[model samples]
Target: MVETSHIYYGTIVHTLSVKNLEIIQQAVLVVSNGIIVKLDRNVKDIDAYISSASCTNYVLHRLGEHEFLIPGLVDTHAHAPQYVFAGSGMDLPLMDWLNTYTFPSESKFKDEQYAQDAYAKTVHRFLRNGTTTCSWFATIHLAACKRLVDTIHDLGQRAYVGKVNMDQNSPDYYVEASTQASLDDTRLFIDYTKAKAGHDRLITPVVTPRFAVSCSTPLMRGLADLAKEYRLPIQSHLCENPDEIKFACSLFPDCKNYTDIYQQHGLLGPDTYMAHCVHMTDDEINLLATTQTGVAHCANSNFSLQSGVCDVQRLLSHGIKVGLGTDVAGGFSPSILDAIRSGFWASKMKKVIERDMHGNSDYVCLQPSELLFLATLGGAQVLGLQDLIGNFVEGKAFDALWIDADRGNVDLIGDLTIFQKLEKFLFNGSADNILHVYVQGRRVSGVPDDENDLASSGDTLNHGVALDHTTKPSI
Candidate 1:
C-alpha cells in the first residue's frame, strides 16, 4: 500500500471564501502527485504519519520572516506571437497599431523557427513572472499555434492556446484565404491539440476570431459553430478603443453594439472571454452578465494606447467576472503584477474623475484586495478553470509563489505583512524579488544562491529564476 506525501508547516495565503476578501493563513497542505489532497489547520499525529508512511516524502519549508506564499497569477489575455514587439507600437491607436505593427510582427510566426524561438521565450518569461497559467492568442499560422502549445507543455505551464481566425478587413499578408479555410484550420488546430493528451495538463483550445472588425458575419458564425461543436472557450478583443468600436458599429450596423455582434452569433456565453472591454455600454454589460461571459480588463494596454479607462467598478456592480490581462505587446509588460498595480491606479483615476464630475464621493473605489482577487481567483473563474486551479483551497492545483520581502535582499523587501507586502510587491517588486515559483507543487524556477547555501545549512528556502526557463521539448 502506498501512503500520500504531505506538505506541512507553511503559511498558505489564498481565498478562504469567494464572497469575502479574507485570505486563509498558517495552514497545512498535503499533495499527492500534483493535486492538493488536504488542507487543515492541524494534522493529527503528523510525526507518526510521517514516519509510518511508505510513499511519503515530507518536505517542510519554513517561510522566511518576510516571505509570504500566494497563488500564482493567471493571465487571461496575452499574445504569444507578440513577444518580439513587446516595447514597440506604443504611439498608435488600436486599429493602426494592429495593422502597422501587430499584423506585420505576427506574420513572422509563419516561420517555424521564429515561432519556436519566440514562443519559448514567452513561456519562460511567464514562468519567471510567476504566471503559472495563461490564456494566450497565437498567430493565424497553424504551425505557430502548435509551436506555442508545444513550448507551453515542455515548460510545465497550464495554458489555453488559440489559433487566431480572421478572414476579412485585415492586411493581405496576415489575413486567411477564406472563412471556410479559417474554420477548417481552427478545427484542425483543436483536433491536433486534443490528440496530444497528457503531454500537457489543462491545455484547452480556445476559438479565437481576432475581433469584430476583422471577422465577417459568416466567419464569426462559422467559428461559433466550431465553438459549439468543440465545446471550447472563445477569446477575442471587444470595445478596446473608440476607433475600433466605431468601425465595428459601422460593419455590423444591425447589432446594437460590439458585444451584440458576438451575442447575435451565439458567441456570448460562460466560456467566452473578451479583452479590453473599456467602452461597453450598460446594455452590453447587462448582456455580458446575463450570458455569464468574462471580461479581461487590460488596464496597461488601454492606458498605453489612450483607450478610455474601463468602468470596472460598474462591471463588478453588474456581477460580471473581470480578470487582469497583460495584453503583451500592447501592454508593454509581460508581468501580471504590473497589470494588478495598473488596475488599482486605473480604478482610482476613474473614481477621482467620477467624483469631480458628479460632485459626490459616493462612488465605490477598487480596493487592494479586489485587485488581488482579480489577478488570481478572478482570472481563474474567467478562464473556466476556477474549479481546478484558482486559490489555494484544498483539492486545487498547488500553483503558488514564495515572495521575499527582505529589503536587504534584491528580490523582496522585509518590512511588510503578507497583504501589505503583496500590495507593495505588485506595485514595486520586480522579477528579482520573486524568491521562488512553484507550479503543481514542483519547483519549476531555479533556487537562488542564498537559498541553496541555506539549504546546505539545514535551512529550507525557496527562490525564483533569474531569467525565463529556456528548456524546449524535442519535437
Candidate 2:
C-alpha cells in the first residue's frame, strides 16, 4: 500500500541472531526504493493479497520451483589488490608472504589502469559469488586506492575501502616514504573516498594500518586521529602468527604485549575490526572485549599461512564480536561461501585441538546455522553495519542472493527440504547456484538478466526494463 517498487514471492532464509536462524516459506517481501518495507510469511495467495492491497507499479520476481532468497554474504576482511594473486602465496608465512607475493602484487596497483582492471574483475567476482558487502584493504598508492573506490561505486557492492598505512618494516619497493608521508597520503585517501562517496551507506572510508609490524608509533597515532575526526571504521591485522607477534612485540618494547600497542595508540574500539586474531593472549582477548572491537576469523588464511587456530568459541564466550574473512591469496578464494565452509572446518579443528589439550573438550562445535550467521549478520556487526544490510528486517536494505539450485552445480535427489538445500549450497554449491546478487534492491550480479523482471512507470530499476500499467504482476 505504501507504493512498493519490487515484489518477491518465495522462501527467504536469514539469521535474526547468532542462534536464531529463521526460514520463512511462501513469503512475500516488498521493497520501496531500496529498503524492505514488508515481509509477510505464509501468504496463502500472493495474487489475492496483491489485489487486496492494490499494490501496482512494481517489478515482480517470483522464484522457480527450486529457487529461494537468502541474505547476501558479508565479507568482513579482504585485500582487494591481493585478489590478483588470490590463489598464490600460500606456501609462505604471513610476514614472508607479505614480502614474497602480497607486497609485490599490491605494489603493481600503482599503475591506474592495472588497478582498475584488477579491481573490476575482483569486485565482479566477489559479487557473482554473493559477497554484496565487503570491507576492502586497498594498497597505499593513493591513485590506485581511489580507483578501487570508483570501481566499487560503479559496480554497486557496499564496501569499506582503506588506503593501507605502513611507514616502517615494509619492503623498500613498497613502503611509504615517511610517517608524515604515510599520514598525508592516508588523509588524502580518506578525503577522496568521502568526496567520492557522497552518501554514508554505500562506501565508507576505513583506517587500515596493515599491522603493527609495518606501522610506526607516530603513524599509528595519526591514523587513529583520522578515524576519530572522520568517524570512519578502522581495520588491521592482529596476532595472526607467532613470528609476526614476536616482531610486533619487539617493535613496541614498552607495551605489555602486541594488542596493547593498539590500545595504547587509541586504535581499538567498537568502530575497529582486526583480522586473524589467531594467537591472541587471554589479556589481549580481554582487551578487545573491553574495547568492544570486532574480529575477522580467517580460518583458511590461518591454516594456509601456518597461523595458529583461532578459538572462535573462546572469542564468543568472552562476548567479543566475530565474523568470517577470506584473507585472499593467503586463503586462496574470494568466495565468502568458501570462507563459510573453511570456517566450519576450522571450528571443528579447534574442537580437536582443545580436546587434545584438555582430554575432554567443552567447545561447542559451530553449527550450520551459526556459521550462516557468521557469514551474514555477524559479519555485518563486525563492519558496524548491522542495522543496514544484514537481514530482511523491516527498513533494512535488500542485499540478497537468489539461489537457483537447478541452474547450479547441485544434483538434487528426492524430497530434500529447503534448509537441506541451503546446507548443500553452503558446503557444495558454487557461484553457479547463486542466480542473482542484489544490493540495495538493485541487481548487481548473477547470470543473464531475467526477462520476467517488469519495472513500472516513474520507477528507476537499475537493470529492469519498464513495463506498462496494464501489465499485471505475474507468477
Candidate 3:
C-alpha cells in the first residue's frame, strides 16, 4: 500500500459555498501534490491515514491565537506598466490623464529592461498586498508583455497578462503599427507564453484591447477571432466615464450604447471581463446579465476620478457578475482591502445619491460579506478560474493567506469569536496586518524577521521619477 502525507490541524475559514460563508473551527485540511484532498472540522484519528512512523514527513503549521486563514485575494484589473504611475495622476480626469500621464508613463515599457524592473516590483508588491491572482494589462510592446509574464512565473503568482492592442485613435507615440501588427504580436505573445511549460499552471495569456475609443473596429474583430481560435479570455474597460462613453458613441455612431459596441463585435460572454460599468444603462446591465459577462467594480478609481459610483446593488440585483478591482494608478492603493472598504462606501454613497436624485429610497445597500465575495469568488468567476482557485473547496487549489489581527486590538478587550475576529480584520485590517501569504500551498511572503528587508528592495530598473500630478479628465 502507498503512504500519503496528510497536513492536519488549524482553524480553516474557507468559503465552502458562495451562498453561505462556512467557518470550520479547529479543522484539518489535507494537501497532496498542491491540491487540497480533505478538509474536516475534526480529524483526531491520524492513524486512519498513515501509521505513526509514516507521519514524520508531514508538515503542520499552527494557527496562532488571533490568526485566521482566508482565500488569497484576486485583483481583477491592474496595469503592470502603470505601477510607477500609482499616486501620480491624482487630479487628472480620464482622457487628459491618459494622454499626458498614463500614455507617457506606459511608453517607457518599450524598453525591455524597464519593463522587467517594473513588472518584478509590481508582482512582489501584489504578493505583499495579498493578491495571489491578478489580471494584468501590459503596454503595447510585445517584449514588455513577455517580460511581465516571465516575472509572474518567477514569482509563483497566478495572472492573465495581455499585450494591449490599440491601433487607432491613441496618441501617436503609443499606438500600434497597424491592425495586422497588433494581431501578429498578440499571436506571438500567446504562443511564447504557452510554449514555456512547467513554470506555473496559473499564468496564461489574455486578449486585451485598450477600449472602444482606442481600438479600431477591424482590430477588435481580429482580436475577437484570435480569442475564439485560442479559447483565450478577454478584458477591457467599458463605460467607465461619461466622457469616455460619449467619445465611444461618437467614434462608433451606429452603436446604440457603449455595451452595444462590444456586443456587436462578439465581445460579450462568460469569459469576457469589462472594467468600470459606472455609467452603464439599464439596457447595458441587462445585456451583461444575459450574456453572463463580468464587471470589475473599481470603486476607488471611480470616486477619485469623480466618475460617479457604480450601481453595484443594481448590477447584482440584475444578476450581473461583479468583482472588485484596484484599477491601480487611478485607485492609488494596491491593497484590495482598500477596494473592499471603497466598495462599501461607494455603494452607500450611490444609495444616497440615487435617493436624492429620485426623491425616494428604493435602493439597497451592499453587505460586507457580499463585497468580500465579489473580491474573492466573484473575481475568480470573472477570470474564468472559479473551479480551480476561488473558494476553499475540498479539492480546490490551496491558495490562501494567514492574516494576523493582533495589531487591530481596540478597547473592546476580552475574547472574540472567530467570525467576529474575521469581521474586525475585514473592517479594520490593512496590508500591514497580513503576516503570511500562500499560493498553491507554498509560502511566498511574510517570513520571520525579514519584513523590513523585503520592503527596502527597490525596483530592478528605475523608470525615473514619475511625472508631476495633474487633474484627470471626467470619464
Candidate 4:
C-alpha cells in the first residue's frame, strides 16, 4: 500500500549468494525512480493492505501464478562486433578459427556507419535475451569503437566498452601503425567514452588487450598504465588453446609462463578478468589467486573450438573469483541460458573424462544455483559491480526480468514446486518467455510501448475506480 510509481506483487526468485537461492511467495515490492524502495513478504490480503497503508498514486501489478521476477542477466565478456557472424564459422580450432572467421570480420569495422548498424542490432539482440549488463570488446578501429559506445548509450544497456589494441602479430590489413599510435587512440577512446557517460554509470571504458600474440610488450605496458591512471577494468584472453599458448610464451621467453607475461606487465590484479583459462598450471592458478584476478569461464567457446575443458571448480576452490561469459561468435550463442546449459554439461564431461580416461572418479560440475549465480551475481562480481546490481537488493537499481514460465516453450503438465518452475525456465525457456525487461525502472525491451496504457495504471490516483492490478502486468 506504499505510495510508489511501480508495485509488483508476486513470487520473487532471487539469489543471496553463490549457492543460496530464495523463492519468496506473496511478496510486495515497491519501486520508485528505478530503485527498489521496499520489499514486504507474505502479505495475507492485498485489498486490506491497500486500505490500511493509505497507498495512492501507484501502479499495482499483480503477477500471474506462473510469473516471477529475477535479476537481470550479466555477460562478463563478449565481442560486440563479432555478432555479425556469430553462427557461421565453427569447424576450425582456436588459432585457425581466429584467422578464418574472427579477423576478417573484425577488420570490416573500420567503416563507422557499418559498425553502428551492426552494433545496434547486437545490443538489441542481447537485450531481448534479458542481458541488461555486458562487457563488450570492440575492434581496433577507434572511429568505429566510438560509434559503438554511442549506440550502446542510445539503447540504454549498462556496459563496459573496450577499444582493442593490436600493434603487432596481426594481419597487415588490421594491425595498428605503431605502439604509440595504439596508446594514443586508446587514451582518446577512454576520454570520449567517459565524456559520453557523463555521470551515468551505464557505459564504462575498459582497457582491452586482444591477447598475448597481438599486442607488443610496450603496448601491453602502456595499456596497463592507462588502466591504472583511469582506474578501469581490463579484459583479455588467457590459456585458451595449446598452440596459442605456445606461440604466446615463445614471444616472451624472459617471462616465466603465459600468465606471467601479464603479471609482469602489471595487468594481473583485481581489476582484470581473463577469459578461458582452459589450460592452466598450479603455479599459474596460484598467480591468479594471489593477485585476486577474476576468470571468465567460457564453456561453450571451449567446446566449440576444441579447447580443453577448464576445471572451474578447481579455480573456485583456489579462491579465485569466477564468472560466466558468452564469447559471442566463439560461443555460437549469445544467450546466457545457453551458457548455463553448456557449463552444466562441461562439468559432467570433465567428470567423465576423469573417471574413464584417467581412472579417477572424482569430479564436480556446476549446479543450477551456481550457474544462476555466475550469470547474474558472479558476473557482476567479476566486473566489480557486485554492490550496485546483480540482485534485487533494496537501494540497487531495479534491473530485472519479468519471466512468464507458462508463456515459453516449457510445459508444466501438473502441479510443481516453485523451484521446479524456475528450473524449467532456466533449462527450457527462451526469450519469448520474458514478458518485460526493466533497467533502472524503465522497460527497455519486451511488451511494445504502445500496447500498455499508462493512464489506466494511474486510475487509482485520479478516479479511484479499478485498482488496475492486472494478472499479466506489463511493468
Report clashes for each candidate as comma-separated counts.
Answer: 13, 0, 12, 0
lDDT score at residue 86, model 4, on the 0-100 scale: 94
Worst ten in a row by lDDT for model 4: 455-464
TM-score of 4: 0.93
lDDT against the true structure, each candidate: 0.79, 0.86, 0.79, 0.86
lDDT of 3 by residue, 207-306 (tens): 9998999998999999999999999999999998889999999988889999999998888899999999998888999899999999999999998887
Q: How far off is model 1, as Cα RMSD?
A: 5.8
The residue-by-residue lDDT of candidate 1 on 1-475, one tens digit each, is 5432436444566664334565445555666556787776644544443455444334555555656677888899999988788997799887888888999999998899999998888888887888888999998998889888888876667788899998889888989999889988999999988775465356888999999888999989999999899898999999888899999999999998889999998899999989989988889999999999999999999988888899888888888888899999899999998898888889888878878999866767777777878888999999998888878777888787777655433344355466776666767776666766667766555344553342123222434312222122100
lDDT of 4 by residue, 1-475 (tens): 5334677888898888887987889888878778898888899776566556644556777777888899999988899999999988999999999898999999999999999999988988888899999999999999999999998887778899999999988999889999999999999999999999986668999999999899999999999999999999999999999999999999999999999999999999999999999999999999999998999988999999999898889998998888888999899898898888888888899899989987888677778888888888888889999888888888888888888888658897799888889899999998887777777777777644422442123122211112365333222
Distance from true location, Cα of 62 in model 3, Å: 1.3
Which should have the higher lDDT, number 2 or number 3? 2
> In model 1, which range of ten residues has the least summed lDDT?
466-475
Where model 3 places Cα greater than 4 Å from the true spot, the runs are 1-8, 16-19, 42-56, 197-199, 358-362, 408-412, 447-475
Comparing 3 and 4 on lDDT, the stronger one: 4
